[model samples]
Each structure stands twice: as structure tokens, then as C-alpha cells.
Target: MTLAVPPTVPDPSVRSAIERLRQEFPELGPAPIVLVVRTCREELRGSPDGALPELVERLARQRLRVSLD
Candidate 1:
């Protein structure tokens, strides 16, 4: 079963990286303050033509909070 995780702000590192990505991909608009758990991961899954997973990996490397059920 999947557990529900509370919404939380990204770490400073994630904020920084996301800001940079935001500038590069205006399609994403502003940097997100809160990560919506699994959906957030899905959003960053990246399109075949785009390479956003590398960017999301930054969060995974940093302190992006998450929980598994």
C-alpha cells in the first residue's frame, strides 16, 4: 500500500536546481515550492524529446523528502 506524504518545500539545492531548469524550460513556469509526492516525480519523468529526468535526479540526489508504503 502507498502511504500519504505531507506536502513539503524542496531543499535549497532543489530550489536552486529547479530555478535553473525553470529558466531553461519556460514551459514549466515558476519553480515549485512544494513537491506533490509521486505526481511530482511523474511530472519530471520527461518527454522523449526532453531530458528532465536528469534534472529531477538532482532532487533525488539532494533532500527531496519522500515516503513509501
Candidate 2:
């Protein structure tokens, strides 16, 4: 008999970070928000789990804000 494995779900903080960035930079719209979040997450992929959410949020915010300037 074989058992099935479930797909890995991303942490909620990732979504939260994305949404917060979207709200903070509405002018950039959904596509840019998603891009920034994904980029930030990738940059911190090796980071400690406990710190990822806040790190992702901060990095994404900075990147998006810089884009606006």
C-alpha cells in the first residue's frame, strides 16, 4: 500500500505581505505587487522561517516604493 503526499501550501504571511504591498502601492496594481512579493520571497528563500514574513513584507515594500520613485 502507498500513501499520498499533500502539496505544500505557502505561508499565509506571503499572501498578507502581497496584499499589504498592494494596498500600499495601489498605483502599481496587482501584477507588480505579485512580482515584488515573489522576488522578495525568492531573495529570502533560505532565510529562517520565523523571520520570513516580516522580511518579505519589508523587502517587498522597499522594492515597490523604490519603483514608484
Candidate 3:
């Protein structure tokens, strides 16, 4: 009998986004915090100061709460 192996998972873009956020907002916790970038282009284009508030609100609406630790 042959053993089956599980497929590899792709690295989530959210992780990098969260890391950048942590660097930009040191008061926030580490990159393990969940983050969803609604608009990738907008996030990459805009300043972190402007982008973070929107990202936080969007995630909150989805009931994915985040906090600075």
C-alpha cells in the first residue's frame, strides 16, 4: 500500500501585510495577527497611515477582531 501525502499550502499574502503593519505600527502585535487586504492595489499604493484604518474596519466587520499586544 502506498501512503498519500498532503498538498503543500501556499503562503498567505496576509502574513506579509500584517508584518508590514506591525513595522509601521509598532504598538500593534506581531505578524501572526490575521489580516485581509480588501484592495491589494490600494494598500500597496497608499500610505500605511491611511491604509491601516480601513483594513482594521473591514476585518472587524467580518468579525475578525485584532488588537495591539
Candidate 4:
């Protein structure tokens, strides 16, 4: 029998970051913005939890902006 794993709940800050990114980069669409944010979150895995949200948002924003060029 296979055990089912529950979906991971995103951190509130991360969710907020995603929403902000969606608003800022509406032209890129939700999928790309989410991918960028998730990538940033993974890259920042070792960072202190207290700062992860802000750092993730900043990094994601920078990446999204660069993608525009």
C-alpha cells in the first residue's frame, strides 16, 4: 500500500511574497513568478527563518526584473 503525503502548506510570508510578485509581474503570469519565488526560497534554505520571507521576496523580485530584459 502506498502512503499518501499531504500537501505542504506554504509559509504565510512566502504566500504573501507570491501575491506581491504576482502583482508586480503580472505580465509574466503566475507560473513564472511562482517558479522564481520557489527557486529563491530553495537557494535561501540555510538562511535564518526570520529573514527568509524578506530575502525570498527580494531575490524573486530581482530575478523577475532581470527576466523582463
Best by TM-score: 4
Runs in model 2 deviating more than 4 A are 1-8
- Per-candidate Cα lDDT values, in order, are 0.42, 0.76, 0.41, 0.79
What TM-score, to 2 decimals, does candidate 4 have? Answer: 0.84
Candidate 4: segments with Cα more than 4 A from true spot? 1-7
Tally clashes: model 2.
0
Q: Write the per-residue lDDT of candidate 2 for residues 6-65, one digit (tens) a residue.
A: 216766667899888788788888987777787777778799989999998998898778
Provide the TM-score for each candidate, comma-separated.
Answer: 0.32, 0.81, 0.30, 0.84
Error of 4 at 50 (Å): 0.7
Q: Alpha carbon lDDT of residue 34, candidate 2?
A: 79
Clashing pairs in 3: none
- The digit string of per-residue lDDT tens for model 4 on 1-69 reads 122232287566568899999988889999887777777777777899999999989988998898899
Off by over 4 Å in 3: 1-10, 31-69
Judging by TM-score, tell me the better candidate of 3 and 4.
4
Candidate 3: tens digits of C-alpha lDDT, residues 4-44: 23224532344455555555555435423333333332333
Q: Show model 1 residue runs off by greater than 4 Å.
A: 1-10, 31-69
Clashing residue pairs for model 1: none
